[model samples]
Target: MAITSANQLELLQTAEAVAREKMIDPGLVIEAMEESLARAAKSRYGAEMDIRVSIDRKTGRATFSRVRTVVEDEELENYQSELTVAQAKQYLDNPSIGDTIVDEVPPVELGRIAAQSAKQVILQKVREAERERQYEEFKDRAGTIINGQVKREEYGNIIVDIGRGEAVLRRNEKIGRESYRPNDRIRVYIKDVRREPRGPQIFLSRTAPEFMAELFKMEVPEIYDGIIEIKAVARDPGSRAKIAVISYDSSIDPVGACVGMRGSRVQAVVNELQGEKIDIIPWNEDQPTFLVNALQPAEVSKVVLDEEAERIEVVVPDDQLSLAIGRRGQNVRLASQLTGLDIDIMTEAQESERRQKEFAERTTLFMEALDLDEFFAQLLVSEGFSNLEEVAYVELDELLVIDGVDEDTANELQARARDFIEAVNKQALDKARELGVEDSLVEFDGLTPQMILALAEDGVKTLEDFATCADWELAGGWTTVDGQRVKDDGVLEKFDMGLEEAQNLVMTARVQLGWVDPSELEADVEDEAPETSEEEEA
Candidate 1:
C-alpha cells in the first residue's frame, strides 16, 4: 500500500485512538496495521517473493521490503526464501550461504479494497485484545461476588452487564423464585470465566453457597477480617440456608458475631436473598458435635458415626423427624453437605424397631449355624455376639456375661463356630482347586485361601485378573438391581481386608507380574505409605 505523507502521519494517531478505545497495547494495533499493509503489498509484488513490511515504532513512516536467505545449491528448498551462493552474488558481493539480504520495494497505491482489509485487521486485533483483557480481569474473580445489571434474557437465561462485558446467569444457577427485568440490579457469584470458540464467557450464579459466604463477608466485619471463619455453607436458595462458623478467639462468639446486633447483619443478608431463612451455627471440630449443630432446631436422640463409611446415623424423636429431615429431606441433605458425610435420619421408633430386627436376625443366625437352642442363641445375642467371628474370637469372660453360661458351654459353642468356618473354608478350597486357581495367589499378602476361591469363582483366576479390578470391585461394591442399589461382597471382604489393604495387595500383584515397573510401584507406595502409617497410628 502507498504511504502518502497524510496517511503515514495519521497511522500512529489511529493506532493510539484504537488502543485507548479497545483497552489494549498501542504497539499491537500498529503491528496489525503493518501486517495489513504488507498483505496489500503482496498484490503489487509477486506473492511468491518473501514480501515484508515495517512501520517505524515512533514515526508513522511505513516501508515495504523483500527478504531472501543465501543457501547452498542443494539446500535451496524454496525459491522465494532461499538464494543459491552463486545467485546471492547479484545482491551482495562475496555472499556466504547463511546470510539474509533485505531489498527495498517501491510502494503501490492503497486501493479501497486494501483499505478495507486494513480496517478488518485492526478490528480483529482489537477483538483479540478485548477477549484477553476480559479473561484476565475475571479469571481470578471466581468465587467472588459481582454486581451487574440485567441486560437481556434469552429463553430462561439472563445476560448481565458487568460494567465492561456481559456475563451469563444460566437458568439452572438462578434462584427458582427470583426474576429480573432488564436494567434491574443483581448480585451474583462469579462461578467461572471460560474461553469458548466465540469468545471468553463469564458464568454467574445466584445459587452458589459461595455467594452466600461472600455476602456474609460483605455484611459481617468479623468474617471479612478473618477473625471468624465460615467453615462451611449449605444453601437451599429462595428457601433456607445453613452456615457453620468458628472463631479462634475465646472471647468472640462466632455465631453471635455473624448474627450481628439484633439480627441486623443476618437480616440484611436475608433481605437481599428475598427472605430466605439463614441459620448461623457455631462450628465444632468433632464430627458428632458439628453434626448435632448442623441438624439444629431438631432434637437428635442418638447419633451413630461410621468413620470408615463416612456416614452418620441420626435418630430423632418421632415428632422431630419431619423437622430433622425438612421438606422432602432437605434438612438432612444440607447437613450432609455441611459436614461432608452421608447422613441417614430415622425416628426413635424406627431405630428401636431396627435394633430389635437386628437382634432377631443375629439370634436366628446363631441358632442355625451353631445348632443352638433359641434360649442359648438369644443369650449369646444379648451378650453382644453379633456374628460367628465375634463369638469365636471373644474372651471366655464375654461369653460368661450371658446368664447361666459356663466355661464348658462357651468353649463348646466357640468350637462349633470354628468348625463351621473350617468346613466352609475346605469347601471353598476344593472348589477353587477344581477351578484351577494357582496356589501362589493363595499365599499373597492380604489374600486368604477363601478369598482366592472367591476370586476364582468370579473368573479372577490369575494375578493379572485380580490386579486389574478396581478398588471398589476388590473390596466389594454396590450394583443396581431393578433400579435399587444392592451390595455384593467382594473377595477382599471375604478375607477381612480393608480397602487400603485390598488396593496394596492388587498393586503388589501388578508389580510382581511386570505390568508395572518396581520403581513406579515404589513411588506410589511412598506417596500412600505415610497416610497408611497415620491411620494405623490413629
Candidate 2:
C-alpha cells in the first residue's frame, strides 16, 4: 500500500467537510476514525492484544500502538492489559508496577473487509453526531413556530424541509381540510424532538392549539411584547378556534390589540388558518365568568358549578338552548375545552323539570332513610339536603340554620348520621379484608376506608403497588392530543376523590414506603409512624 502523509491530509479535509456540513465538532469525527483504525490494527496484530490509535489533527497522521501495563509477576493477567516487569524489561530499561509501555506498530492497509467495517463506523458516528446536533437545535425551540416547505409525503405524513433539517408532520397533526403539494410553504409548531434508535425524529404540527397561539403571537405585537398573555387556546381545526387573552397592562385591551385596527390583526391569523373562525375572549379569574366568556354568543341564564367534580351545569333561556348547544353539541364541546371543565347544558324548562325531579328524590330519601315526617323531609329537601352524606357531614351550625330545627334536634340528626356512616364503613372494611387486602396497606394513613376497598378491587393489594403509582396514574390528569392539554378523564374520578385528595393520598403512600430518599424530604414520616401504628393497634 503506497500510503503517504499527503494521503492523510486528504482524510483530514474530508472529515472537516463532513463535520461542517453535519454541524458537529471536527474533533469527534477524527476520534471515530481513530477508533476505526484501532480496530483494523487489532485484526492484523493479536485480536486479544491492547491496541490504541490517534490521528494528528493538523497533519492528519494516523498512528497505531500496542499497549501493555507493567505489573508484578503474580498480577500479570494477559498481554491485552498487563505484562510482568521481567517481560517488560526487553522493551524498556526499567519498568515498575502500574507503568505502561507502548510500542509503535505499522499502519494496517484498508483491505476490502477492513475498509467496509471502517466505513460503517464512520457513518454510524456521523449519524449519531447529526442526531445529537438536531436534538440540541430543536429541543429548545419546541413549542415555537417554524416555516417549512413540503418536501414529500409518505403514508399520509408530510416531510417538510425546515431550514436546517427535515421534519415530519403526522397525518393527525394536519388540519382536516388542508392539503399541501411539493414546495408548498407552510407554518408548523415544533411539537417534539426525540432521539430514536435510527436518529433524531422531529414532530411538527399545524393543527396544534399552540400553532394557532404562535400565529397570534407573530401577528399581534402585544402578545409578542408580553403586554398581552394568551392564557389558553382551543381549536376545531379548519373550522373554528377560541383563544383566551389577559392583559398585564390594564390600559391595553387584549381583545382589541389582538383584533387590531379594522380587524387586520385577527384577519391575518384567520387568513393563515384558511378562514377558521376566531373568537377572542377576555380571560377571568372566576371560573364561572371564564366559562361565560368562553361560551360566547350563547346567552346563559344560570351556571351551577360543581367544583369538586370539575363540572359546570349551564341553564340557558328555552329559546337560546339550540344556540348554547350549537349544531351537534359543537359549541358546548368547544366551551368545555376552552374552560377545562365538563359542561352539561340545559334549557330553562329542562332545568326546572330536573330541579323538581331532584327535589322529589331528596324528599323521598330523607323520609325513607332519616325517618323524617313528610313535612320535615320536604323542608330538608328545600334546604338543599341532597343526600344523607351531606346532612351527616355538614356542620351542626349549618343544620341549625334549617327552619324548625333547634340545636338539640341538630345534635340528634348528626348522631344518627354518624351511626349510619359507621355501620356502612364497617361493612365495607369487612368486605375489603375478605377480598385479601394487606393489613399494612389497609392501615396506611391518608387513604379512606372506601379508597382502600377500591384499591383492593383494582388488584392493588400491596404497599409496593400503591407506592409505585404516579400521581397522575392514581388521580388522572388532563389528556393531551398532539401535545395540548385538553381535559381530565382521570382514573381517580371513578373513586369518590377530587384530584387534590388523590395527590395527597399517593404522596403519603410513597413517603411511608421509603421509596424516596431521606434527604429529599422536608420532614420525617418515621416520626409519625408510631402514632399511626398505635392508633391501628388500639
Candidate 3:
C-alpha cells in the first residue's frame, strides 16, 4: 500500500469513522494516524533518522519530513539525526546549536509487514485515547447515581453498560442476594472512577449509604432544594438502614418530607434498595439526644457520654434492653454509626449495679489510702470525693460540711490525706530513679511523680526521649484498623493526660532544648487565632 493522492482523503475518513464509533475526539484519531505513518516512514528512511509526518485537516494531504538538530560538537551523539553547529553551516547561512533543520521527504511505501505494524500502533493509540475519554467523562460523576443496562455477569460481578462505557458492580456492592441478567435495567451509585493500566474502571455500588441518601434526595423536594440536609446514613444493605436528616426551614419536618404523603417518597427508595427498611431520625446538635432518636422504639432511661473517648453509655429499662440492642445488636450499631460514637447499651438494673460497684471501689480506696474507718470513708465518698488528692487539697470548709466533723477533725483528715499522697509520690519518684530516669525528665513542669514513673517504665527516661514522643503516645487514642476502633494505651494516659496537654508539654520541652524557636511558636499561635470583626471586638 502506498500513500498516493487517491487514498489521501480515505485516511481522514477512516479516522473520523473510528472516532465517531468510539465516541472520542476526531483530532486524537488523526494524531494517532500521523504517529503510525511516522513510524512506518522511520522503517523505510532508516531507523536512525528522525522521520516526521503530518496530515492536512481539510485537504487530507500527507506530508513527510526528515528532521536533524544542530548540537554542540561533543553532544552530537546521533550521526543521522544530529549535526554539529560548524557542520550545519553548509545547510544554512548561520545555524545555532539547538536549531532543527527540516527537509521534505517522500512518503513511505508500506509493505505487508510495515502496514500490519502501522495498524497495531494506530489501534493502541486509539484505544488509549478512548480510555482517556471515558476516564475524563466519568471522573467528576463519581458520588452520583446513574441508570444503566446490565451487560453481563462475570464471577458474580454485574457489568453494566452506562451509556458510553461499562461499569462493574462487585458482588459485595450488591444489595443482599440481588441478581440481574443481561439487559436488566439497573440504578447504581457511581462509587469511584480510576484509571488503571488495562483501562478506566468505573465501580458502581447499590449498597453504599450515600446511595440511599441520593435516592432520598431525588424523591424529596426539600432535600433536593437544600431546605433539608441528610446528616448521616448507616446501612445493613437490603435489611435495614438509619438516616439522620435536618431541616433548615422551621416549617418543614425533614422526616415527614422524606416519608412523603402515605410513605410514598421513602417507599420509592425502599423498593429500589430491594425493600430495605429505613428509619428516618431527626438530626440533633447534642450527640446523646441524636443517639436516643437513632435507637428508635426503644425507651432510654439514661444517656452517658464520654466526650474525650467518643463513647456513649445508654441505659434502658430491663424490658427495653433487648429492644435497644435489637436483633444481633443492629439497633445499637446503627446508632453508633449515626452518632460517630462507640455505644454501650445496658439495662437500668445493670447501670445501678455498676454505679454501686464504683462507689464501693472509691470507698475502699479512701479507706486504705487515708487510714480512715469504713464510716468516715463512706461519708467522704458520699461528699463526691473520689481520690486522696481531692481529699487532701479540698477547701477546709468542704470537709467541715461533713456530718460529725468539726474544724479539728477536718484538719486531721487533710493531714492524713496529704501525708499518704506525699508518701505515695516519694515512692513513685524513688521507683522512677531506680528505672534510670534522668533529672531533666523528672524536673519537667507538666509531669507528676507518677507520670514520670510511667514514662520511665516505658523506657522514656531522658527529656529528649519524652520530646520525641508523639502526642498520642502520651494521651491514649483510638485507631481504626480494618474498619474497627482499636485502643492504643499511652504511657502517661493513666494520669488523665489529654492530647492538647501532651502536645503543649512536648512543645515546651522542645522550646527549652532550643530545638524550636519561641518566636515561631508565638507566630503559629497567632496564625491559628481566629480573626475577629471590629464589632465583635467592641
Candidate 4:
C-alpha cells in the first residue's frame, strides 16, 4: 500500500463526506473516476493505444496498465510493436496467433493527468447525484405548504429559499396587497414541482385557492377534524372570496364555527390572505334557495329558474341589486361559480313587469283554447288555473257551484268540456304516433285514428304527444284549435255528423281498421258525453 499526501488525503475524505451526506454510493464515485481516467488516457494516447486504471479506496492509490496490439512489421513509428514467434517464445513458453502484450506504466508518468481527470469526474458526479436527491426530496411535497425564507425579488417575482431548495413565487401568485422583503419567513403553498437541468424547480403560490384552504385548516378545528366540509370555494385573492360550507352534524353551525367567537377563526385566515373578505355561506340542497343564500348581504325577493337556459334570475329590491351583483359583478360571479349557475340579478319592478307579461300570455292562451267567456277566463287566471288541464279536469258540478254558474250554463260547460278533452286527447295520440310513441299511446287505450287525426290538426303529432312535446315530454295542457265552438243552446256538439251511432261507431270503426287494439279499449275508461235537453235541441 502506498501512502497518500495530506492534501490528497483531505480531498478523498471530503469526497467521501459529500457522498455520505448526499446518500450517494461511494462505489458510483469510484466508477465515475475510472470512466474519467479512461477518457484522459485516450486523450493522452492515440486511438490505437488502450489503457486500464484502478483505484484503491483505502490508500487512494491508482495503478495504470498499457496494452499494445501485435503486428507483423515495425511500420508504425513511436508505437508499441508486434512480436515474432522466436522473440515471443523468449518471453513466454508458448505464443498464440492473435495475442497482446501488457505493460505496466510508472505511476509518476500518468499520476498528474489521472488526478486532475479524477477530480473533475468526482465533482460532476456529485452535482448530478445531489440534483437527483433534491428532486426526490421535494417532489413528494408538491401541493403542500412549506415554510421558506424570502431570498430575493426579481422583476416582481419573489424567490423563496425552502431550506433544501429554492422556489419561484411568481407575481400572479403573490397577494397583491401584501409585500415580501428579503429574509422574511413566510409560508407558501407549493403549487408545482418540476425537474430542470440545473435542479428541482418548485413553484409556490400565496394567492392559490388552496392557500386559503390551508389557512382554514390551521385556524378552524372543525375543518381539520372533517366535521365541517368546504363544499366549494371561489376567490379574488387579497380582495374577497366566497366559500360554501356544510356540516355533517345538525348541531354544528358551519358558518358560525368557521367565523369563530369575535371573528377570531376566519379573521386569522383573512389576515393571512392579506385581509381578503370571505363570505362563508351555508350550503343548501335546493339550488334556488342556495343561490339566494350565496349572494349574501343582499336580500332576494324571488328566484326563478330557467332550466333550459341553465340560468337563474334572482329578483332583488332595486336598492339591493348592486349589492347582489357586487363590485364589478364579483359577488354574483363567484356565486355562479360556487353554485354552477348563471345568475342574472334583476330589480323588483323589472321582475314584476316580466311576470305580468308572462301571466297575460298564459291567460290569453287559456281563453282561446277552452272557448270560455272572458269573465271565467280571468277567474281561472286569478285562481292559478292558467292552462286547460286545470280547467278541463275541474269537476263540472264543482265549477257550476262557483259564482255566476247556473245549471244550464253548467250543462253547456260540461258538453264543451267533453269536446275539449276529446280534441286534446286525439291530438296527443297523433303526436305520439308521429314521435314513434306507440308504446306510450298503448298505455292510454281507446285512441282512434280520427282522434289521432284530430290531434294532428291541433298540431299534436308525436308520441311525446301533448301541447308541449319536447325531448320525450308529453305536454298535456289546453291549447287553442281553430273551428271549435260552444253552442248557444248549451248543448256541446260538432256539426256535419250524419251517422246515428257516431259516438259508439267511432271506436268500432277504429278497431275494425286495426288502428287500435281491442285490449286498449278494455284498459281505457269510456268518457260519457253530457245529455242534451230536448227543448234546447229543437
- Strongest candidate by TM-score: 3
lDDT of 3 by residue, 265-306 (tens): 999999999998999999999988998999998999899998
What's the distance in Å from true for residue 430, model 2? 11
Question: All models: lDDT?
Answer: 0.85, 0.84, 0.92, 0.70
| Model 1 pairs in collision | none
Error of 4 at 63 (Å): 6.1
Worst ten in a row by lDDT for model 3: 195-204
Of candidate 2, the 10-residue stretch with the lowest lDDT total is 483-492
* lDDT for each residue of candidate 4 in 187-262, tens digit (9 for 90 to 100): 8999888777873378899988777887788888999899998888888888899889899989999999999999
Ranked by lDDT, the better of candidates 1 and 3 is 3
Error of 3 at 449 (Å): 1.3
Best by lDDT: 3
* Candidate 1 per-residue lDDT over residues 1-538, each given as its tens digit: 4687778879999889988887788888888888888878886676778878888877788888899999889988889878898998887889997899998888778799988887797788778777878888888888899899998889889999998788999998988767889999998899998786573389999888999999999999988888999999999888989999999888999999889899999999999887889989989889998999999989998899977656689999999999999888888878987998878899989999999999999999999999999988998888777899888888888887777879998899899999988888788878888998876676667665678887898888877788888787877655669633466676666655567777778778888878889898678769886454766778
Cα-based TM-score, every candidate? 0.89, 0.77, 0.96, 0.58
Model 2, 1-538: lDDT tens digits are: 3135758998799899999998899988988888887877788787888889988888988888888889888776785768888888898887888889888888877788887888799889888877887888888899999999999889899999987788999999888857799999998899998888773289999889999999999999889999999999989888888999999997999999999999999999999888999989999999998999988899989999988767799999998989888887778878888998989898889989988999988888787777788899999888877778888889888998988899999988877777777887888788888888888887887776777787777777778878776666667666779845566554455665666777677767777777766465555645555465766778
Candidate order (lDDT): 3, 1, 2, 4
Superposed by TM-score, candidate 3 places the C-alpha of residue 155 at a distance from the truth, in angstroms, of: 3.2
TM-score-based ranking, best first?
3, 1, 2, 4
Candidate 2 residue 199 C-alpha distance from true site, Å = 3.5
Cα lDDT, model 3, residue 305: 95
